[model samples]
Target: MSIFEEEILMLIQCTPRAGAQWPDFDTISEKDSHALAAAFQRASPFPHLVMDHLFPSPMLQAMAKEFDTAAPSDWREYHSGLQRKRGTPPGGHLPPTVQDYFNVVYSGPFVRLLSRITGIDDLIPDPALYGGGMHEVDAGGSFEIHMDFATHPRTRLVNRLALITYFNETWTSEDGGALELWELEPPRCAATVVPHFGRTVIMEQSARAAHGHPQPIREGRQRRSTVAYFYTNGLAARDANDTLATTYVPHAGYSRRQKAELYLRRFAPPMIVKGLKAINKAARTRHTRGRGSKL
Candidate 1:
C-alpha cells in the first residue's frame, strides 16, 4: 500500500469504536460523489460548496463541546488590525475527540472525496498545519479580506483548497461574522455564510480568491470553526518574497482607526506588539468574566 493509504489506516485506528459508525469511503455512494463534483464544477462566484450535516450528530455535538472547553493555552493568539483570532494546530498531539475528527479529515478516503468534489486530483493534506486549524474569534474580532498564501512555507506545495467546519450552534445574522467572499477588480461582497453548526465550506483557493469576515462580531458571543488546507506539488517555485504571506486588500472608505492600527502593526517592534496584545486580551477576558455565566 502507498504511504498515504498507510497513514489513513493509522488515523482510522484513532477513531473511537463506541458502537457508532462514522462516515467513510464505503458510506459515500458514487452517485452522491458525482453530483457533488458537478455542483462545484459549475458553482458561481467561485468553485465552492456549503455542505450541511457533514458529520454524525453525536460527533458534531462533541466537536462543539470540545471547542468550548479547549484550553486557552492551546490557542495561538493572533492580534492585529487585519485579524484578531485564536487558533491551534495539530502538533503531534491533540485531544482524543479532536484527534478523531481530524483523523477522518486527513484520511485518504476523505481526501479522495474532496478531490471528487473539487475536481482537483493528487491533493495532499498539510501535516504541518500551515495556516490551518481550530480558529476562534470572540466579540469584536475580524479577518480582513485577503487572498491566502499561494505556497506552503515549509514544503512549497501549491495550496489548493480550504475546508472549514463551523461549530457555532447559535450564530445568527445579527452576529455579523459571516465569511464574506469578495470580487477584486471592483471589490464587493459576492456572498456571505453564517457560521452555522455542522456546516462545512469547501473553497477553491486561488490567487484571486479573496475572502474574510471583515465585520466585528457582536458583543457577548464567539465564532468557532476548524480549518484544514490541502496542497499539491503542481506549481513551480517563485521568488521567496513573492508569496510567503497572505496579502490583505483594504476596502474602500477604510476607517482612520483601522488604518492607524494597521500602521502600528506594520511598523511597531514585535515585542511591543506582543505586549499590547497581551494587555488587550487580558482586558477582554476580564470583561467577559464580569458578565458571569451565560450558559
Candidate 2:
C-alpha cells in the first residue's frame, strides 16, 4: 500500500503512545482510543464501540462488490428456521481484494490497534475464521438475542472481542436488521445498531454481552456483514464445565412461536433439525423466488 493509504488507515484517532506500538496505519486517535478503552473497562454491561467508515472507502467498496457478486454456492448455508444465512470462509475462492483487507486485519499492525483500543493485550486473530468471515442474513431471517459461545472451538482460546463491519448501503430502520445489544440483569436492550454501510461495531464478548438481530429482515433486502472474533490466552474459562456452546436467551415480548422455535433448536438432534430446515427452505423457495437465499 502507498504511504498515503497507510496514513488514511490511521484516521481513527491514536495517541502518541499508541504510535510506539503500531507506528504505521492510523488506528483511532489517542483521545478516542482512551475513551474506547475506558468504556470497555466500565462495569456497566459488556462494553462496545460503534465506528463509522472503519476502513478506507475504496477498500470497503471493493469488499462490498466482491460479496454482492459472489455465487451462492461459494457460501456455506446456515439455516436454523428462525435464522437463515450464509457464511463463507476465507479460503481458496476469496477474491484478491477481499483477501487484501483480511490480510491487513490479520496482520500485527491491526492486532495492536485492537489491543490499544480495547486495552486488552496479546490478542490473537482466528486464522480459520470459525463462525467469522462473510455473513449474510436473508429477508425473513432472524437471530435471537443470546450470548456467544465463550470458547474457541478449535484453538481453545477465550473469545474476547467481536468485530462486525456492516455493508448494507441502503439499509434503514424499516429494514428490520439491527444488531441489538441486550442487558440481562433487568432484561432490556442497551443499544441498537443499524447495519449501516461502512459502519463497524466492536463488541466485547462476555457472559453479560447478550446480542442479536431478532427482527426479520424487510422484504427485498438482505443484511450483509463481515465478522471476525479476537481471542486471548490469559482469560479464565467462564465456568468449571468449560462449555463452548452458545447460550441462547429469549428477549421479552417474544411470541410463543418464536419461543418454541428457540427451545426446539436448543434441544433437537442436529441431523433432525438440519433436515427440517432444509425442507422448510426448499418449500419457501419453491413458492417464491429465493433471490440468492439458498444459503
Candidate 3:
C-alpha cells in the first residue's frame, strides 16, 4: 500500500469504540489532517479525495441492510431523461440504521474532519437533505454529467462540498456504473470511480466539478449510495458562483431549447432567474400532486 493508504488505515484502526458510532474527534491528528489536506488539494481536474474501507464495516453493513429492506413506497423517484433513480425522502425520513449514519456524519466531529481534509472551514450540514440522501439506481439507470446546484434552496447557503459513500457489496467493470469526473475546459473525462462498498468520495463542489455515472447499470444489478452536501457562507473566489440550480453539461443530451434556457439563466439577473425557478417549481409541485407522487 502507498503511504497515504497506510495512514488512512491507521486512522481507521484507531477509531474509538466507545461513545457514538462514528469516528471520534481525537482519532484525526494534526499531522493526519495536513497529509489528507495536501492530497485533496493536489487531486487532478478538481479537488477530490477517494478512500476505500475508511468507514466502520459493521455500520456500513447495517446501512446496506436498511437499503435492501426499505419499502418501495419509501423512495422518491427521479425519473427523467437525464437521470433515473430513487432517493429516500429528506428531513430524517430514513430507516433506523440509515438515520444513524447521517446523524454521525453530520455531527461536529465528522464535519471537522471534512473541513480539515478539504481546507474549507465552517461547513454546515443540511438537516433537510434537499436533494441528497440515500440513492438507488436499478438496472438501466443512469445520471447525465452535471454540476450540482450552487445554492441551497432553503438555507440559501453556498454549496462547497459533497461526501458520497457507496454501499454496493459487489461491483465490477461489467456493471457499468462508474462515477466519471470531467474536465471543463476541454470537456474530457478526468477520472472514474467504481461504486464499491465502503468506498467514499469527497469532492469540492464548484462549476468545474462536473460528474455523473452516465453508463447504465448492468442487468440484475443496482447501485446504492448515500450523499451529503456541506455548505459555507463563502469561500475561495473560484468556488463562488450565483447559479441557483444544477447545471447540466452541454453535450449531455440536453435539447436545443433546454440548452438555450441554461445559457439565458446564466446571463439573466439573479432576481429574474429566481423568479423563473419559483414558477417552474410551482408547476412541478402541481404536476406531482396530480400524479399522487413526490419527485
Candidate 4:
C-alpha cells in the first residue's frame, strides 16, 4: 500500500472509536486534558487550540469526496468586499459524512469535553448551524479580518467558540488560505494556522478573537473546511458591547480609501455615520432597480 494509505490505516487503528463518530476527548486522560487546557490558555492572541490528525483520515477523505461531488446549487455564494466564498445554507442538506461529523462533535460528551479543555461551562450547539457548515473559497476569494457575531440571531445565545476542520489534502503555504489570528490593540496578525488536511482549530470567541483568511487562494486551488460555533446562555462582561453582527476591520494591506472608510465608521459621529449609511443604501437600491428595469 502507498504511504498515505498506510498512514490512514495506522490512524484508524490507533484512534479509539467510542460512542461518537469522530475522535472523542473522553478518551483523553486527565493529565492530557490539563496539558491541552494550558496550551489553549497560553496561546497568543487568544485562547485556542490547534490539533493535527484530529479526525480519522478515512472520514475526512469521505467528506472531501462528497464535497467535491456536491452540486453548485447546494452552496450559497457570498460575493462582497469583506468576504467572497460559498457555504452550505443554514439548516440545508449536507453530505452524509459531513452531517455525521457535525452530529458527533455536537454530542453531549464532546461538548462537555470542550468545556473541560476551555474552562467554559454550559456550552450549547446550534442545530441549525447558523452562519456555518461546509465552507469553500475558490481562487480570488477571501474573508477579511473580522470578529464574529456576538449573539445567535435565532436562539439569542451568546457566541462562545468556533471549531473549524480543514479538508484540503496536499495544501501548501503557496495555496494562501491560512487562518490568521490577529492582535486587536495594534491590529496585526499574531499567528497563522495553515489549512492542511486533518487539522482542526478551536478558538474562543470575543472582541479580542479577531481572525480571517484574507489572502486569495492561488489559481487552480480551492480551500475547504467545515465550521461549527458554540454558544452560552450568558454574555461575558468583556464582550458586552461587541457588535451583534460580524464586524470587519481594515487590514494593513488595505488601500487608503478603504482604511479611511473604516475609520469614518469607527470614529465618526453616530448621526453622521448613520446618515451616510442611509445614503449609501439608497444609492445601491437605485442602482439595483435600474439594472432590473434594463433586464
Provide the global lDDT of candidate 3 against the true structure.
0.80
In the range 207-259, model 1's lDDT, one tens digit per residue, is 66788998898999899888889988767422223375776766774578768
Query: Clashing pairs in model 4?
Result: none
Candidate 4 wrong stretches, greater than 4 Å: 1-15, 18-21, 237-242, 256-295
Give one digit per residue, the lDDT tens place, for model 3 in 149-186: 89887787889899999999789768988888888776
Stretches > 4 Å off in candidate 3: 1-10, 235-240, 252-295
Every candidate's lDDT: 0.75, 0.73, 0.80, 0.81
The candidate, 3 or 4, that scores higher on lDDT is 4
Please tell me which predicted candidate would have the highest lDDT against the true structure. Answer: 4
Report the lDDT tens digits of candidate 2 across residue range 194-226. 888888877888888888887899999988888
Show model 1 residue runs off by greater than 4 Å: 1-20, 89-93, 236-242, 260-295
Angstrom error of the Cα, residue 129, model 2: value is: 0.5
Q: State the lDDT of candidate 4 residue by residue for 93-180, as single tens digits.
A: 9989999989978988679878988999888999789988999999988988998998888888889899999999899878997898
Report model 2's TM-score to 2 decimal places: 0.80
**Which candidate should be chosen as best, given TM-score against the real structure?**
4
